[model samples]
Structures are given as C-alpha cells and as structure tokens.
Target chain A: MDWNKILLFSILVMVHVPIVSIGQEKLAMQWENVPEEIVQGRLEPQGTASFQRFPQELQKEVREPVWQLSRNSAGLYIDFESDASDIIVEYDVEDQFSFPHMPATGVSGLDLYAMDENSGWQWVRGIYSFKDTISYRYNGIKPAIKGSLRTFRLYLPLYNTVRSLRIGVAENSIFKPIKTKEQNPIVVYGTSIVQGACASRPGLAWTSILGRYIDKPVVNLGFSGNGKLEPEVIDFILRASPSIIVLDCMPNFRDSQKAEESIIKSIERIRAANDTVPILLIEHAGYSDGFVQNERLEIYENLNKATQRAFTYLKSQGINFLHLVKKEDINLGKESFVDGTHPNDHGMVGYAMAISKALTEKEILD
Target chain B: MDWNKILLFSILVMVHVPIVSIGQEKLAMQWENVPEEIVQGRLEPQGTASFQRFPQELQKEVREPVWQLSRNSAGLYIDFESDASDIIVEYDVEDQFSFPHMPATGVSGLDLYAMDENSGWQWVRGIYSFKDTISYRYNGIKPAIKGSLRTFRLYLPLYNTVRSLRIGVAENSIFKPIKTKEQNPIVVYGTSIVQGACASRPGLAWTSILGRYIDKPVVNLGFSGNGKLEPEVIDFILRASPSIIVLDCMPNFRDSQKAEESIIKSIERIRAANDTVPILLIEHAGYSDGFVQNERLEIYENLNKATQRAFTYLKSQGINFLHLVKKEDINLGKESFVDGTHPNDHGMVGYAMAISKALTEKEILD
Candidate 1:
C-alpha cells in the first residue's frame, strides 16, 4: 500500500504490456504465413515439398519455418525470408531415409553456383563431410538477375536472389535416361511404405527404383499411414491422371472383410474414372511369425481368398487388373524383417526386385 | 459512499460465499482424482497415450490417456475399465496398410477364438459386410469379465493403426490361443509404408501377404515418413532378435548423399550387433516417364548406383545380403500408375507379382 510500492507495480505492469504485445505479434506473424494449402488435408497434384520427422525427444528442437515448392508456374521460391548470408539448405535426397541421427558418409556431393549475368554457371565438388548439413555461402552478394512471374522459369540473367539451385550427387543419383517412344507416369497409392518409408536412399525405394528403371517421372502420393481409400484422395488420383494406379492398402485393414470391400470400392471408383487404367492389387508382405498363429493364419487365408475373388470379379468385368499374391518366394521371415513388419535395406532391395520381376512378366513396362 | 449501498453489498457477498464454496468443492474433488504426476508432466508411459489421427482431417484431435510400458518390460499392455452390460473395446490395428484412407478390399477376413483357457484356438469367420469397417459383436449376455486381458496384437500394427482398429466385436467371444510354431516373431523397422499406409485391407499389404505365405508372424515397425535410419531403432531390432532384417528405408531418403551414407551405416550397425543375419536391400520402383524428366531420372541413377556399390562393399566384407533392382518391366506409362507415385489396385498386384517372382528366383523364400 506504500506510494513507492504502487509506483513500482505501475512500472512492472507497463513493462509487461510490450512483452505481451510482442508475443501476440509473433503469433500473428506465424498464423499469417502458414503452410500453403496444396490439397487442404492431402497433397495436391504436381505439388513439391519436403517433410521432416523428428524423434519424440527432439521433436521441438528442429525448426524448419520455410518450405519451397518447385512448380511449373514459377521457379523455386523461398516461402520464408531469411537474413542469414550463409544458409544451409538440407533435405532428404533419398525417398525414405530421412532420419536426423543417421547422416550420409563417404558419398559423392554436388555444389552448384550460378554467377552474375555475365559470368557463366560454375560447379564444384560438394563435400559430404558434414554429418547432417548441406550449405551454400553467397557472402551476401546479390546476383544481377531479373525476376519473372513464372514459377518454372529458370531465368539466370535476372537472378537477384538464389534462383535455379540444384544439387546432384553420384552415389545417390538415378540411372541414365532411356529414350522411349512413350512415357507414362506410375501412380503408387497405399501405406507409408508405398510412400517410401525407411529406405536408406531415395532411389532405393521400390517406387523410386522402378522410376529409375523406367526412366520416367513418378507421382509419389504415399502419405504416411493416412493412405486410406478416402473418396477425396481417389478424387486426387483421378485428377492426377497417371498411367497406372497401384492399390497397396492391406496393411492398414486388419479385417479381411473390410479390406476386400474397400478394394472393391476403390477399384470401382477408379474404373468409374477410367475403365482401362491398369489397377494392380498387392497383398500384404510377411510379418513376424510370432504374432500370427494358426487362427490368425486362417483369417489371413480368408482375406487372401477374398482378394482373389475380387481379382476374378474385376477380370470378369473386363477391367485391366493384376493380382500379386505372396508366394513362398517373396516371404520375409523373421530373419528378413528389420523389426517384424517393415523391411530393412536388404528387404527393400528384395521387394523391389520382386516388383520389377512382376512387371516384367506382365509386360507392363518397356 | 452510502450506508445503505455498503450494507447491501455486504449482504450480497455473504450470500455468494456458500454458492462459491460448493462450486469450488466440486472442482477440488475432480482435481483430487487427477494424479499429480500427470499435472506435472511426469506421467508413466502407460499414462500417456497418443492422440488419434482423424481420418478426414489427418490431424490429431484428442489424446486418449493410456498406460505405458514399464522399463525393461518385454511387451506393451493397455487396460480398459468398463462395467457396462455390453462392452466393445477398440484399438488401432497397424501394419494392415500403410495409410488409413486406403483399404484393401479384395482379401478375406480371419477370426480366431480361444476355446479354453490355455488350449489351442478355434477359427471363426470374419464377416466383411461393412465398408472399411471390421467389427465383431457379442451374442450372449454374461457377467463383466474382470481382469480378463485381450491383446489385439499384430506383427506390423503401426501402419494399420492410422485407420484400422482391433475391436471386441462380440461379448463372450472366446480368446484364441496362438500356436507356437506359427510364431515367427520378426521385428520390422522401416518408414510409414511398412507401417501400412494407404493399404486397402489387412491382408493385401505385402508384409501380411508374406506372413501368410511363410506361416510366420511379423512385427511391423513401419513409422510412415519418419522411417529414417536411426541407431536407436536398430538397437530395438537387435533386442527383438528377429531372424532376418529387411532394410527398406529408401523412398524416405530422397536422393541425398547423406542418405546413401546412412544406409550403409545402418546396415553396418545392425550387422555389428548381430552377424549372420540375412539382410536384404531393395531399390525404389522406377517412375513413369510422364511424372519425371531427364534431370530427376539422373538423380535416381545416382541413388541406384550407390545402393549397388554399398551392397557390393558389404558382400566384399562377407555380409549376407540381397538386392532388388528395379526391372525395366513396368514402364512409367499411363497404364501403370494411378497418380505419378501411388499405384492403384492393379499396380499393387503388379508389385506383388514382381516381388514374388524375384524372391522365387533368388531363393530367398521357400
């Protein structure tokens, strides 16, 4: 109740106002620049972006505020502003191996540098010494290049900012391009594994490996565990209009009945969109033998039978479909599995080989 | 300033005391039941449960508190307290599919019922009437089964859990006893796809299909896009003591040099922990020509070469390994893909066939 105390309290209250105001301002700024809504809940067609998964302990430590998309409309654009002169742009080069703790070692690296308008392009051997870092230092020197409205425009002369930057490494690179009369994109829609989980390198993923083999672009729509046959996602597939549609959602459906019905519905939906689009149905891979017993095996048998029936029905409907049953050849026993379900690197390679063989036998690819 | 006003205010204050006290007491009662540790963020693992992913929004809506596994515990346990006349328990069933949206529609359903307390189980037919829903219901009325433990376990339950749930469909349904020889407990550690993403059914996933073929059980550790090569996860694999380890963390790695290096390191770590374990390496499936261009194709080449080189190096060191290169059979033409990346039902089938053939040729299975 003293006058001095009152004055002190007043000063403290006044000091707290700006702090609260600054906090509000910061929150407002974040809300203003939220990630672009490509497909609202799902990824949009022809959208380009990267996601990083963190360990539970370090989830809050890594901060990636800016995300850029490489689109046909305009060249790569930094979604956020950065004042740092020397910025490290790190991204997972492989399809599935993006763990923070595991850094690439003893692999070829690439560093790309685009000089001013008069100077030509310069390339240097990138260093793969850093455990988890990819950096480019500009020394704050702005390029004398013009800006364009197009997202795909690689206009080098008017490049004021870091435009047209790409890193190419040899060990993790794709095969040489194969000239073909016709090239169609392959659409793989299924579980997280389909989306490229745990593959040590990008090209090592079955999808990516398939892409390199065919020398064509592949639209990867494998959204982690969210690959349920949602009507909206099917709509996206329809919109994308790929050459083929692969449905690999068995791992998510524990009940064979549900899996059978969903497969039928998904096939119907795709057939509704495009009758002749080749739709391949794959069965779930091997899990640890300990979890599934005789009863579980019976259930799996029922599910397998139902799947076969669907395949038969689709074939009767004159729909172009392929059924890949898990024979003894492709079984991953306890020794084959890294944990009990997901395949480790060796398992991935084996799986990719199996897929490649299937495609070859069916004469689906060139 | 007025005596009458002051008196009225005092009377009002006195009247409000009991009302406020009662409300406070109720609030305090609720707080008393709340554990102090939970309030202080020191809850046990079982006490902290993950928020369920909403199928439509793909966002975490509510957090369901669950008991965590105690330290040094071999397995996970979840308990539900219910006294209703009829109780139906449900939990996410993972590894059926990588994602929740896509369901495997063609596979049959399996149901196992425990006939006696410790005897082998009996088989029950699982009905697939509903769409994307697997349910079992209780037929007869009975007393509340106290301390009755029901473990809806799976080899790769992580991926399927996104949209899959193992529910107590019927009351008085016998709990099935798992067979011993049928238990091929292998732990799968990979990305989300291995966890079962957009799979259509529980049986159609490659992992599940393989499990059926081999007559073994699998533990799915496919963590969607987060399947980076982490040493801790590898350590978990070692402790699980699976016979084989399948490495399929390629798609998540993209085409980074760091990812290539990590792939090698992860393999080495696993081998170092336990030698003579069969490790299979998989390559990503090639993309359709429509989706990617020459530059991107080059990226795939680099990654593929890196994988081959790593495999060769590992072999030189006398490591038991297998490689699944992407065959040029499935071209990235219009007929193969639904979108650029995800394959439809037809694609899944083709993938399975390819994998099956490769495994047979390599003699990895059987």
Candidate 2:
C-alpha cells in the first residue's frame, strides 16, 4: 500500500513537473513573425510566479480546452501603436458556437476598437465568422484618432476557443506594444453565464464589463455547466491566488443536491489553503419568469435556500471578510434572461453593475 | 377633381367595409364543431365595437403587416376553463426565427401555461415550430390544478405572425373563457422594444409585464424601427381612445432629426384629436454599452437631448397632463440590449419596471 501511494505521488509529480517548470513563467506560445516583441495586454505573464492553474496535459484533457484557455485572456485587452493604414490579425480556433442570432463578431471571434480623437474608442473591425477552425484573419481600418500612433483594443470571443493568435500592422509600418499597470486579478468562477453564454459579442459579457468598469485584469473561471463545486476545479482556482474570488456556481447544481455541503467544503478547502483573500458568494439569479411560473419560483427558492444556508454556515465559521451577493441586487427578473437560462448582453450589464457595486462596497476594488 | 376624390373615398370605404362591420365584436372564428365553446383566452374580441386600430385592408398594406396585425393583441391574454386531462392548441404562423439562442416557443409559436394546485402557474407545452402557413397543433399535459377544471393563459409570439389560434381539452372536457374587469387600456407607442423583440417569451416583455402588474389592457403600437413619429400610426392609436398614451419613440429618430419637433407635433396632433388623454414621454433607455463606446454615448445623448427639448416645449405649451420619463428611470445601459439596439427579455423587464413606477407615480395606472 505504501508503494502504491508512493507511485501515485510520483505520477502526480511527473504530471505537474512540466507545468511547474514553466512555473510562473510566461505563457508558452510559438511567437508569430509579427506582434514583434511583447504580448500586449497580457496580465502578469506567469513569469516565474507560478500563475497557470492547470497543467498542459489537463488543458489538453478538458472537453473544451478553449473554456480553460479562453477565460485566461477574456478581459486582457491589448494596446498597440501602428502607423499602417490598417491592422491585421490571425488566429487558430478549436471550437465555435455558431449561434445564428448572435453574430460571429460577438461569438467565437475578435472585435477591434481604436481610441479616436473626438469619438473616443470606436469600433474598428471584427472577425465576423467562426464557421471554420482555421485562422480568422481580419483587416481593420484606422479610426479618427490623432496621428499615426494609435491604441487598439480587441475582444476575444465569449464562448469559444483560440488555439493561437497573432496581430500586426500592414507590412512596412511602425508598430509598438503597450501594457497597463497590473491590478489585482479578479477571478470569477461559475457556470456558463459567467463563461458568457449568448452575449452578442465577447466584450459584452458581465465579466468583461466588470473588467472595463473597474479597470482590472479579470480571470474568468466559468466552466459552463460544469461549475458544480468540484474540489478539483477549486484546487485549480487556488493556484491563481486572486485578490478576490467569486463563486457563482449555483446554476450548475441540482435542487435535490445540497449546494450547501459542496459550498461549505469548497470554502473550507480554499480558506485552509490561503487566508485573507476575500470571497464573494453569488446566489443564482432566479429565473426571471419565476414571477408568474410557480414551478420556476419553487426551483429558484430551493436553489437560493441552499445558497443562504451555505452563507449562514460560512458566517458561523468566523469568516468576517466574506461577502454575499443576493439575487435581488442582480435585479434579474422577468426579462433579464435569454431562453430562460442564459443572460444576453442586457443581463450581462446588470450582472456586471451589481457585482461592481458589491465589490466596491467590500473595498475589494479599492 | 371633386368627383375623383369622392370615388377614391368610396373605394377606400368599400375596402374597409368588412373590418368596420366587425365592429368591436368578439373575434370572428368558425366556432367549430366541439372544441366546445369560446376561444379560451381572447378579451372583448372586437365584438362589433371597432377596437381594431386599422381596417384589415389597411393592415395588409403596411411595410410589415405582421408588425401591425401582431401588435393588435400584443399585450392581450386570456383566462379559460378546461376539464380534460390535457390541452391541445392549434395556430397558423407566417415566419419563424429559428435562431439557436431564441426558443421556438418564444419566437413564432404559442406557449400554454396552466395554474397548478400548489405550484400557482406551470408551463404545460409550447407549439415550437412554424413552417409554411399551415396549422400547428400542440398537446400539453395538465398541471396539478384542483379538480378537473383548469385555467390556462397563453402568450403570443413576439416577432411572428399569428393568423389564428385555438385551444381545446379532451373530447368530453369543459371550456369557458374568463374576461377581466374592464380597466382603462394603456396604449404604448415606441420601437421594436415596445413591440416585444427578443423577449424570451411574449409574456416577459415590459409591456406584457405592465399588463399583468396593472391588470389592465394595453395597446402596443411599436413598429420595430418604424416608430419615428409617423403621423399615420398616431392616427390609428387615437382610434383606441386610451386613457393614457405613452410615446417612447425617441430611439427611432436619426441624430440629425429633432425628436422634439416630432414629439411636440405628435402631442399636438393627439391632443387635438383627444384633449384629456394623459401623455407620457419617455427618453431612450441609453444604450447599455454606451459607457465604454463613446460613439454610442453621443448617439444616446443626442437623442435624449431632443426628447428633453420636446418635454420642455410641451410644458411651455401648458400641457399639464404631459409627464416625462428620464433615461435614468429606464436604467438601460450596455448590458440591456439584444444586439446593441433592441431590448432582450431582460431589458424589457427593466424598461417595464421603470415605466410602471413612473406611470404609477403619475396616477396613470390608478
């Protein structure tokens, strides 16, 4: 039995060695010919600081590596200067949710905006198709910003994957990368809503909205329907050591299951591993149609009841730094949902505003 | 020339004869062999009283006849009795927006809901397909309502054409339509937002929410993008003789056009036609994504400025009954739009809640 235990430990170490060796190192990528030097808008690029939450093998094992890779750079927009008349981008993608109502400019694609003189940040171009996994190259014309030097911001797809990406100006034009001062990472973990379901475009997701609102680096840990308080996922989240952690996984739980039990255990594990990091427990935004639909109301009530119980348990544990965000504060009601489950752009805005306020009140953003 | 004008009027009268003859009478349907009785949820049913705003011929001539015909019963719903074990519904539709994100139950078909014994209201079934101009039949099992008798409510599609609809119980079941106590109909005039675009289901629209909240009838005259203060549409709304009129058409105007000019003129026209009707002027919801996108912000600002000017002008004209709804009240920002233009279900709710509060404050619903 001892030999078996040793073998397991050896295997785990072997599995983790490459990941840790890459340790707090910059994300490993095959640098394209363009994008010249620095990866613009990258937040604290793992660089010897041990920031990656998953091993390459684990990233390879996930049903959708895009979800894992996608969240890392969702709100990590870049700024760059180029004297060319136009900009160009190329990216390789694995999966794309081709929702017809939501355009590709918003879904598995890229949207570019440039800072303009009088117009401020204006839309420059968007990679408006995600039907194929090949590189999506887009050409965006310059905005009315003064001078040849310009700052461009690009939004990644909300619910898709980018295997590789490269950006540059038209040939023979000047180019320079820009970066912002690092803010404490705000890591949001939850269900598909947090992963940004149905937002017309990636930038419209609540997590993305909150990122711009607070001007911070945001790591999205939303796992679609898989955010059911799994300890493995929690362990992954702990690696980031985010300044504030948001738990918004109630939507992925069954009513019969005790989210309270999973939540309590998750918090306990998280606190034991790291103390002083503020945690925000978010209750599910009750079904907006629940007002008239009784079964829906019951479902919402049961889910929230479990969440409240979990909060109560957490408070009893002497967690004074913890904060609770009620569904009411999110203000989700009859019309805030898409397909009675996911949030559209409007819903994302409400969620972002509400979370922004709660974080501000907690002084987490301060 | 006089004879020619008389002839034209005669032909127009002939074209409108059948619709005018229907009067404000109950809906005209075959009253077939044993679906048993009244077409379950219809209200006063145009029972020979001339409630319809346009003649059928006139309705057919519009750019999108569906918009006009669809809005007639846009906010209207019915309550009914059924003793059968299950429910069956049939409807004929024109188009279906089979977008993955939008549910067929919400887009081009019917949604049937019943009150359960303890559950209040439960969704029974939805006729979620609309191909061609054929009747679509759908069956839904019964909820746990007390006894064999059941009350059912249904929402019409938000963006499609419903030529006719009917409901039925089992062969030997009972059927009766329940009508509401007459309340002043609240007539709303705006863009597609008022017409219930992107609402998860029709019942979730702000206008629909207000209808349920106030327990009053509502006449929706929203024309998608065509709500740009067209005098012809107002002429039709005036035919309804509503107790209060809400003009939320500012979103439809171009930045170059003055919303105030159109608004003041619309009010003057309405007042001339019906002096005492209270008019509520609502500012635009202000694009939810406007905070980061300056161009969008400018557009919103310009539109609202014109609306404010109109509000001020109306006050100058001694319009005591005119009330203005500020953009702040509607609370729409970047996250509230479906595609940066129309309100999704969530946006509709916020809009409805804000408008409801304002109308209540002004004693409009009272």
Q: What is the C-alpha lDDT of each candidate?
A: 0.39, 0.60
Which has the greatest TM-score? 2
lDDT of 1 by residue, A100-188 (tens): 11112101112223222342222211112222333322222122232211111011100011212222111211212112213355666
Scoring each candidate complex against the real one, what DockQ results? 0.02, 0.11
Listed in order, each prediction's TM-score against the native is 0.35, 0.69
| All candidates: interface RMSD | 16.6, 5.9
Model 2 CAPRI quality: incorrect
Best lDDT among the predictions, by candidate number = 2
Lowest summed lDDT window (length 10), candidate 2 chain B: B13-22
What value does the interface RMSD of model 1 take?
16.6
Candidate 2 C-alpha lDDT tens digits along B1-366: 353344234222211111111124322222212221222222233421121233444454455653354334344455676654434444555565433334443455454556665645544433233445423232334434545577766666666655455454444456666655455567888887786665656676688677655656776666667778767667767776677889988877876356778988899999889878999999887764454345656887888888888788788888778999998898764445555566665677778889889988988665
